[model samples]
Target chain A: MTVDVGICSTDHVNAEVYAALLSELPDANLVGISGESRERVRKQANSVGAAAMSHQELMDAADGVVICSTNAAHKALVDLALRNDVAFLCEKPLATSLATAREIRDRCAESDVVAGMAMPIRYSRPMRRLKEQYEAGAVGELIAVSGVNRGRMPGGWFVDPEQAGGGAVADHTDHIVDIVRWITGEEIEEVYAETTTRFYDIPVEDVNLLSMTLSNGASFIMDGSWSTPQKNSFWGDADVELVGTEETLAADCFGYRYDHVSDTGHGRHTESIYWGADPNNALLRDFVAAIRGESTLAAAATVDDAVRTAAVIEAAYESVERGEPVDVDR
Target chain B: MRQIVAVGPETAVRAHVERYDRFDDAAIAGLVGVSEACADGIGAPRYESVSDALRETDADGVDVCGPGAVHGDALREALDAGVPARCDPPFALDGDAFDGLVSLASDGEGWLTAYSPHRFSRLYDRLRTDVDAGAIGSIGVARIKRTAPFDGAGWNSSYAGISAAADPVDALCAVLAHDADVLEWTFGAVERVFARARSGGRYDHVHAMFAFREGGRATIETTWSDEWTPEPRVDVEYSGNQGRLHFDEHDTLTALRNGGDHGQVAPPGDDCRGGALRAFLERIEGEERPPSAVDPEGPSRAVVAVRRSVAEGRPVTLTEEGSR
Candidate 1:
């Protein structure tokens, strides 16, 4: 059966990436797109060969809607889906703050509509293999978990504090945090982060270094920064490493690449190109499969998972403000 | 005798391919670079990448090439297989990993050593001689600037693997680590450090100022831009209370001092890497241990301190008493 997927917005990695992913999945159809901007939504819908829709109309027509708006705008769309009884998939962080994230997750739990967090990196083949190995005791009891999710600064509502909720720390940290939580099944309990605006001139921070403690007492450090320059960086990265008593497991979703050297008559310069299958395709495939009650290829994160990540990020921001370690307060 | 294999990405072990015939004792045989395309070089490709291949690979001795991040695990696998191993600079990042390797090496069956080909080079050998001869007496400050016009460090993720190459520490491990070794080797142990790193994408520029425990200071600046040069251009200058000494990539050394007499000699440019490899093999054979082949704990400590200084936006005491 075809899974009719409607996009809620078309900005940055949401509308464009989802359309590209849907184009690859035969069972998933681009039914419609709903956004605050009618013209923009119509433009995106035309590009993807789908209908332009309002918030409620998209929910009424499609089987599920992807919350692709800015971070702060996620709660409203999720609330709309909760009331409409429409299955919804949300891009990471769940919401801008812990309170809102908890509210959305609590409401979704009370309802019957399917709610999933769009952590596409969970589908990376290397990470999936590592996770399986960890589960099978390839690595003994976990000693520590460290990760990095460095990316090119995506200019949009993401740079705006109000619209995006937070800055580079939240934007990049949540992805790795979710993956760590998934692999270890332990929530991050304490957070101490050092964040600064080193890359861009925007108000929100771009460089983040965090030290966290998991419920199992394993330590975690993350370099979640907008340090990838648009001109030179090969691609964004989502890397995680788990150290156990016996072994250390590491995987980088966007790590496979080769250097491409070409002269454009300017000078001898080298460009790094990513060489691997896109994980976004697998993420959307599993989301569609979960919606259809099929065996999911990559299990989509639930609302509770997203809330846990949000709690860690919220505590991280507090750690940055207070200049010390703070409890995650989950 | 058994041949020692160089296992890592192609470019990292490329020097081994060209100078393979020069080694008298050790033969560069199987699994040179980890890539499939690099199989036809000096050694035949036996395994794919560094993932689990070293756990039980067939080699009497191994050279762990590529980034400094994976050095610990890779070395562990080699030693665990009862194969003596040597690694490229900045041996390992974590103190625990370094200490673990030391403990494993202490077990006696398979030994681990650091690879500093330059230490075996005539150029650095003479540089050390000049320092010993007090050519630049009572050195007050030292500076090294490296500008790589043609080094493909930007796309290092190609061969070094994702786990090794693509972080802000990429330059720190590959570029600055080489210089940090020289800086620490030339000066005494580092007591404190302050560093500032600005990433144009993946941390292409790095600057760090160091204060040595023996009452001297030094500064290091390195840039890995897209400008193409086959070899990285490194310029070193030492300013002293008595005189100054300077050197560049051209194999020429300049020295000047207060009391008049100063001697100049050209350092060896080519054919030294093979000698370095031969010496490393001898060390593996239980001959005299090679210089710069220890735990390299000082450089590792400096790297950790540099990272902390960058994160905290302040100076960090590297060798503080009772500090990890």
Candidate 2:
């Protein structure tokens, strides 16, 4: 059976990428698109040969939904999908805060609809190999883990506190935290963070660092900084290095590409060499397969995992405010 | 010309001799070790203790390369003898010990400093220059990662010869001494520290977060494990309002501004040990006061605070008054 998918809120940066990936899947049908702006939704829908339907009509017709709206609108869209008993692939940070994330997770857990968080790092080939090596004891018992998610400060609504919920700490913390949680299979017990608006004149912080201890007693550090300047070719890096008893492993989730120097508007701009599979496409493929009931949600982040990450981010923000390490509320 | 007595195990003393030989103006006058085993393979006159070296060497300065626990007594003896001294990191065990040594140096006709080669590194010099010039605006965050290969035989043997050989805390402090110096030099005084340390037998790894008193944050992650990188991995990045400066292990510094101006800055020079030795010799000649760059007390107190944070499992705050 074809799994009908609808794009809710076609205005996000990932909306087009998701639409294109869904259109390529054989068993997945891009049924419709809905957003706050009808004109943009129609244009986005027409680009992918899908109809621009009202929010409720799209929810009623699609078998599954992809929530690609701003951070503030995630909970309401997920609520609509849950009410319609349709599965969903909510964008990263299942919700803006812990309360909403937990509420959404609980509702999804009580309902029959499948809920997955869009954390593409779990699907990256290098990350998968690293996780396999950890499980196979290539690195003995995990002792410490550190990662970096240093992307350029994403402007637009991302810098808007009202729409984005927060800045670098809010947008970038969950990906590495979720990846570490996935690799170690341990929950974060405490978080200490420091954030500043040092990189850009944005309303929220563009540089954030988080130090955490996992339940297994391993220490973790994350540099979730939007410190990458535009002069660099690539957008940013998502790399993790793990130190274990027997050995250590370091993986750059996006390091499989080549580098090119282009003489563009700027004298010299470094660009990424994309030589491997796209992680976003891999994530969409898994979402389609799960929606088709052909696979389990083990590889994908569940709503519960999102709540856990949200809790950690919450604790990190609190630590930043209090100038001390704060315990993660389990 | 200046004559320097080296004190430590054979390996550490030999390393200091090699560094001194690189400088034309300084020579190793004598060697001091705890036993004949500690003096093995050394061609210089070997003394049984720091006091013996001080009495017999006729040296202008002393270089203390002993274990972390004995650094205080070594420095005290060198200062009391009216000879300037250069010691390795974890210069003292605690703040009180550090202050006492500083007081001795102040009262005596001698100067004291710590060996922090990174402060003399050309890359660090450029970054410091840029920060002082407000090229990166007000500093918000800085990160430094230093990872070295785990030499099981080297650390196991050296640590075993120390008096506090069984204390893991002392061993880890000695390993992280240089890191503490780098943190204090770049970020100013660290007001607070929270650290998590792990050990895999021979090598210990520490990941620490710092809250600088000057309203900024920094992190230092140092590991001496068997992670085989082609070379030593060191990366330092500073983030500020106007731009960012990055120094990779390749000995290259890149400054990227927010408005699209990007360029590479040439490093000042290498031979941090050579520069440090010259500074020590100059201090011995009364050509200058203790070079502020090599002040041993700042790093000593920082190391003490970091150790306290790790042992207590909480953030340890270092007030200026308390540290002094």
Candidate 3:
């Protein structure tokens, strides 16, 4: 049977990406799209060759719902998905705050619904290879890990604190945090962070750096900055470096590039050349497989994983406020 | 020409001598080590002790490169002989020892200097120049990482044991002192420090967080693990209000400006030890002053602060009273 999937909030950046990927899944069908604006949702739905339905209607009709709404809308949409007994893939962060993320996680655990967070970096081929080598002791016992996720300041609701939850720390931290946990199989135990809003006039921060200690005696540093300028040739960078007892490994999550310099209006551009499978399609395939009971959730970000990331991020924010390292509530 | 008595037959000492020999103005008059066999490895005249080398040779200065514990005694001997002295980091065991050396150097006519080869690297120099030039604006955060292959022989020393005459943590701190000096040079005086350290078998690791007096922050992570390749890995990054600057062991300097302007600068030459030795000789000639290239006092205090933070299980403030 086809796994019917509906996307909420067509305005989200990943909504169309998910819609396109889901439509390509052999056993998955994009049933409908819903958002706060009917006209916008209808336009996105028509463009993706799906039906535009109300949020309640979409929840009732789909086997799995993809929550692509703004940060503030995740709790309600997740609640609706849980109420309808549907498997859901919520965007990263799981929720706006630690309490809300935990509530969603706990509620999902208590139910039979399959839930995952949309963490595409974990599914990327380079990151997958790095994780495999690290787990196989190719780099020896893990000693430390560092990551950089520098991207252009995402405008729109992302800059609004109420809609996005926090700034660069909230928007960019969870992905790398989840990746570190997934690679090392360790949870973050404490965090010391510093944040600043230096680049933009927005209320939220654009630069954040977090120093974290893992449960397994490994230290981590993450640079989550929206400092990429508009004039850059590429979107930004997502890279990770892992140091171990015998060797060191570094993976550029988006480093496979093919530069194109044309005299047309677009000028120079550096296109990221993904070698094999598309990460989004891989995530969708796994989600479909999990919903069909064909396989258990493995590499995909699970509910607990989402909550752990939220906890680290929450502790990071607290560290920023306290001006010291704060213990993470696991 | 300035004739120098080189102390120790360690690889670091030999490397420094080899680099310094490239310069025509400095000459190694003798090689001193605890054992004559060790000193005989070098081409220069072999001596069993620093005093023997200084007493028998017309040396103008001494380069102390023995184990960290001997640094204080070597410097005292050099200062007593009234010769300029240069040593690597972890120059003294504690602040009091460092202060005593500082007083000796002040009273004597010979200059006292410490070698921090990383600071002399062309890439590191460029980073300092860029930051001072306001290329990246005011620094908000700085991070430095150093990882090297573990040498089991170093762990055999009682100093490396958990219960030694001195704190075993100092063994790791000695390696990290240069990094701490770089942090101080790039940012400013660290006002506070919190750190965590672990040791296993022949390896040790330390992760420290520093809050600077000028409102910036820094994290320094150093490790001597068996897993790293033969070539050591070093990385320094400075994130500022207007941009970011990064330098790595690959001799690459990457600058990311706020408006999306990215530039990679690679300076020529990898002769960091040569640069440091040249600086030392320059200081000996009265062309420079004490604390040239690397300040022994700053890194000494940083090590103490890190050790205290680890021992007290709290951040150590760097104020006048708290540091004491």
Candidate 4:
């Protein structure tokens, strides 16, 4: 069956991904796009031959919806999707709060629509290998995991905590949490976090360090910060390291093409292992495959996952207030 | 367990003592002699006459932080004493000083010297790593900005006083060498640099810009008097078609794609200084030399870049003649 995809909002990374998706998939017709203005929506949906329409009208015309709106507007967008019996792809940190996320998840669950989360990194080859290695005992027993997902501060709505939920934690927690769960074969049972703002003066904490205890006794640390000095230039890389009893495997997620670098540091030196595929394209292909029902949803981060991450975010603010650890309920 | 001996004035010794874990200063009389101490008033290391202390001590290296005038002499003496030596930057005051020391270091074991700590920062190393990993695609543009508030304390004593009294031209030349070496480390040899430097009567508040030969440019602005210290804010702004990369001192990386919010990037740890120092020390232990000073004619090339750029309001092409 031909799929009718309605892209909601053109102000996010997922909007570009979804727009690019329409270009890649000829079978997928982008019937319309909804935004604050007809002009804005028309501009974004122009290349896909889609028209600009009111939110309700666009929802009514589509078989599926892509909710790439700002985080605060996610619940309302999902509500629109549900009213029209449209399955939706909710760009993540799914809703600003767990209650909102659960509300959407429950509503989508009761509908005939298939729902998915925009967590493309999970479908990347390196993460797939990392998951495989964990199961094969390559990273034996998963002693610990660490991630530094930092970037320069960007413009607009992102700087507002009310709109984006949080800073580095809001933007970064998904990929790290997604990969950690995939690698450990367990869930983050508890999390203790601390957040600080040292570099930029954004209202939300730009630097946050989260320590999580997994259900399998493995502990992990995630340091997410937009602490790069504002020097009129480019952004940096996101890195992940999974340390086990026998060996350590690292993924230079942005820089090195999501390649794995292994080190025993005994007699042998580090070796770069290629995962083979541009991760961006890989993620898109996986999303398309899922949309076509050719594959089961390939373990993208759910609203549940984002809510859990937001729980860590909530605990981080608490820790910042109390100057001590606060337990994070998953 | 290793001990370090610093034989210079309190000011000279403080910087070294603060940086190295183990450091001690030898007596002025013990190093140069009684009379030489009377001349400089203990403000400088007895670069020419500090042989006795060098022969007596078993320290790994001696950082000759003496005045510029006597640095060549003190360095010559230290080299003869065979303790393996490094001195406070510039190698010495002029081409002659650097040449003499280069000759001595060429023949000696455990001979390495680095004048500035900024070059050894983790931020730079991480930038180098990203460049190596092809993070921002081809690295079309690489910009490094180092600016600071102007002040008198460090200016009168540390920077201006030393550079001016020695050889104003050579001092700027030496500082340029450090900048050139940094650029060379990331982008290959600087084929050309059209540069300009202005010292606003106040020695500390100097500004300079260098347009590199192959592609891109760099600007270094420093003032010892500004209220806010931008000392901790060295950033390498690299722009590529695919993505733009920012490597700043705070250990944060950021990338912007198709005009959305920047995707956050991970960075190396804060231990890049200690890491570089440890690497330098280990390289010495392994009997390898530190990366050669930018080039033999590096200072002269830098001098040409600054001279021509300052001379002509417009850009100047750095000729192959001055290059190392």
Candidate 5:
């Protein structure tokens, strides 16, 4: 069935959603654009050739929707989408707070709607190869992994505590946490985190180190800090190295790049242009395939994964507060 | 020039002798085998014991290139005689031996240090300089990874202390001294450790996390894999509040800016290939060299803590004195 997809909210994430949808699903109809601001919605709708509509109207009319709103607004939008029996794809975090995330997850379970969470990292070429290699026994029984997902602190609503939820720990922690679990086929059993606010004066922490133990007794420590520079630098990274009984393997999804230094954009800056396959394209392709009932979303994250990772992230915050290790809420 | 006696098995002493070929200020004077009787140790006069070798030869320093088992005794024999000596990693097999050697080294007229190709490599020398100068700022996390081909036969035969008879986990911990030494030199003493190890058929892989006394943390992963490689993987990464520093070899260092740009590399340097023997001789010759090998006291304690952590299946805390 050809699906009519509407995008709800064109706030911070609206551009990527529009670009990715068109790049991956060229023939798919973008029927509606909805947001809190009518003017912004109208402008984005015109730009993307989508019709501006209310969130309720968009949900009722379109077969599915993509919510790129701020972190806190996810649950409400998801509730509306589920009530209309409209399938939807939510961004990185399902919701801001764990309580809100759990409520959204439960609501998702009760509905027959096709829901997906945007964890595009697993779709990267290097990460996909890393997972395939592990499953192919490239390394024997994997015992430990050390991963880093460091990014520049994106200012604006991302730094806003209520809008983006937490700081670096929240924003940066999700990608590698999702990768580690997805690649290794193991759930994080516990987490011990030490967090600090550095590089950015935002109300949230920009640096965080989390030592996590996997369900199979293997362990990994992820340095998921938003420590990159926003200007004159490559955006961020998702790199991991795993050790197993027979061998060791490493992958950097964003590592293959052409380093260029020139008096360009920001005046005398060095940045790497990553020539790797765009992960967002792959993620949206899988989401669209699942929405059209053509295939299951093996390449994209489902709503349940969002809840589990939220539990880990929530426990990490708790562990930092308690100054000790905390059991991941399963 | 300094003449050091290579004390160990033929294979072990030859490893030290080979390093001497690259040094200008040092030469292997003689050899003393630990267990088996060895003839002409690669043209150097072979002796029965450390005392006998020192008693007969004009050797001024001792190089305990023996297995982990005899490192404590051979290095002790020289240091106690007020002779500057260097030994292969672990320095000692057990806590008592380690404590004894540390005490003697502190009081000895001649200095003592451990021998490692990596620590003495031009690679780490420059990195150590950068780290000491805070080029990357105050680092909160440092990760070190080492992987080499597991020499199963040689480990069982020559390395007695770390032979399969010992607890495999402890044996592996004993071998991780070089990695621990790097951490100790860069960061200060580790206050606590949480270690986990796995054995396929041989206990050859382990992951150990350290909480530094100087307000930082580190993860050290060492693996002796079944696959063969021309060179071992040596990855050292330091994540600081300001910037990050990472390197795997002597030629280049990928320096990340305060807001990290991963592709940045420091300019290549003049081939500054300093060896352990050269470092020891420089200290004996009193040249006031920059950044010699650190005291093995901290690394020894870390090994002990890692062993205990693996044994207890929990995190082990190290006190100022030792493992608590």
Candidate 6:
């Protein structure tokens, strides 16, 4: 049975990559593509040998919708999907604003709709294995976790805090949130975040660091930045490592390669092979599986998760403004 | 651990394979550069094109230092080839492509990543000790402030792109994520956060607050884009009920055991960084506790919390029991 998908977005991730994902899944049918431009949509669809249609047409034809549009459009598209009674998968950061996210969440809940967030990092095999280790007591006792997703900036909507929802924090924070939530299966208690805009002239933040306590008495720390010095070829990279009580595992979850090539000296270098599978595909596969009644949506990040993340982001900004820790109101 | 075959334009290819000479003999490696002059002394098989590089190398991994525009495809190609890789950061030119790369990495196994040369830095190693020792006593608060100025083209080019356009607080997110080796190595989980970004002259800045799984808290601010006469500096302060730890790359253990000094005894030496790295390498060699690089998911999860904090601007908590 082929699962039909409608990718909705003008962004590069949606337009190009999602299309490729569609091609990878033999059972997935790229029925339609929708975004801001007809030409671009057609190109994206054509690239994957899929059909292109207007957003509404694609929404109506598809069994499930992949909302890859900008943050602002999340509510509108989700509402459209709900009204159409279609299951949906949305990119991380369900919305740019809390109110809008709430509206989408409420509608989905009211409709008893199935919605999954595109927090693909949770699906990584390493993460899955780590979670298992934590559960199995491989680490003796789960202690703590920390992460960084720093890189030089990539301009565009990312520069506009509103569109991208506050730069590095908005872009980088979700991955950290989802990973922690998935790994420990814990809930965030209270949150107080302080943010600053000092690196870039853009309206939003270029660098951000956030910390939180889980319900389990565990502590987590995360940092994100678009600040690495740009080189001739590579822009930036991401890495993930974890520590447990009994054991520890460190891997380049992002598969960043570091090597030394000398022109006049003996060259020594290192590279990485990505053996980890994509969490997004797993996310989509999970969503599709849930829709097919083959499996339950146990691991997927939901609208509620996005809401919590939003609430945290809101508090972080407030904390920055107040120069003090701000409690996150449940 | 991973094999690489250099790929670029014709004149840029190297003739011999360059394995990591600095590390263990077990390590596998590759190189990719644009100039043969760049690849001259490097012992790696350099290809004229990425396609050839993929075909020529039996690498389980590929490190892309290719041109920017083609980076998306380069990463896609590596992942498509079922080869995990560590590419330069800013992962892509836009969010969509970058997100796609992330999606790809997540889907693939052995796909771990981080930016900045600091994760491998010595200071990070030392800091991990204090965190793991619980020396700070539950880490009530962790604060970091990083500042740098743009001297000219050096400052502009290096800091301009994202640092100039994005929030410095986001930079904190990246740093925290990368340095998170300490956090994940110590605490256990992460959650709850808020964030804000603003502009200060040509510099971009970001500030953020976070809630740790337990009762811990963190705040960070990053300043970049402009050049000042003074060099660069970072101030890290960790506070606990017992005492506080002050660290500044150049000068660590600046302030400890103040105001009663936590009433503790027995302090470790300051060689924590080297010790940790040595430990890391030992773990890698299967002679120690466990290697930090073995599992990459937990750290990524911490990063996700940071993203949630920035996106929601409200508290994002982890699902961990009691920590909340």
Best by TM-score: 2
lDDT of 5 by residue, B36-109 (tens): 34544367787777878888888878876633434566777787787777664666645677667777767666
Candidate 6 wrong stretches, greater than 4 Å: A12-14, A140-143, A192-194, A228-252, A255-275, B1-324
lDDT of 1 by residue, A1-330 (tens): 998888887654667778767756788887888888888888878887889988888888878778888888888889888888788788877788889988888888799777788778777888888889989987677765667776678887889888888888779887888889888888888876656564556889876667677798666766676765565536557888765555556798877889989889998777888778878787787778877878443377788888888888888898768755689888
Best by DockQ: 2
Per-residue CA lDDT of model 4 for B221-318, tens digit only, reads: 33222223333234456554334566553444233334542332322112322333344344435554455521233433454455454444233444
Each candidate: RMSD:
17.2, 5.6, 6.3, 19.7, 6.2, 25.5
Model 2: per-residue Cα lDDT over A163-227, one tens digit each: 87789998899889999999878899999887877667789988788888989888899998888
DockQ of each: 0.03, 0.38, 0.18, 0.02, 0.20, 0.03
Model 1's DockQ score: 0.03
Per-residue accuracy of model 6 over B51-103 as CA lDDT, tens digit each: 56777766654544322223456557766665554432334433455456556
lDDT of 1 by residue, B1-324 (tens): 656677766665665544555545556656734566676644465565343445435566777765445556667767666667766566656556656766676675676655445565566667767876876665555666664333322111112221345554455445666567767777668876666554442114455666678755566665544322224456676654444567775533224323542233222123344545566566777754434335565765676667666566555776443113
Model 4, B234: alpha-carbon shift in Å?
A: 19
Using lDDT, give the best candidate's number.
2
- Give the Å error, residue B91, model 4: 32
* Residues A1-330 of candidate 6: C-alpha lDDT, one tens digit per residue: 777887877663544766688667766777888888888888888888878888789877888878888776788888888888778878767777667777778888888667878777777766777677677766444444556666566677767766767777777777776677776777666554444444445777665666565666444556665544333123444444343434434434656335444455645433333445776678777877777777677787788888877776776676667655566654
Worst 10 residues of 2 chain A by lDDT: A227-236
* Pairs that clash in candidate 1: A229-B201, B149-B227, B149-B228, B149-B229, B150-B228, B150-B229
Question: Model 3 Cα displacement at B91 (Å)?
Answer: 2.6
* Residue A175 in model 2: lDDT: 88
* Tens digits of lDDT, candidate 3, A162-224: 888898998999888888888888899988876777667789988777778889877787878
Docking class of 1: incorrect
What is candidate 3's lDDT per residue for B88-110, written digit by digit as tens? Answer: 66566555776677677777766
Give the Å error, residue A6, model 1.
0.9
- lDDT against the true structure, per candidate, is 0.67, 0.75, 0.74, 0.54, 0.71, 0.56
Model 4 Cα lDDT, one tens digit per residue, A1-330? 667777888767558667766656655677888888667688877767788877788788877677878888988888887777776778777866656767777777677555777666676666677777777877555655656665666647777888887776777677777777766667776554445454454687655556565676555666565654344233544566665545556676655423334456654332334345656555544555566776555576665666666666666666557644456656
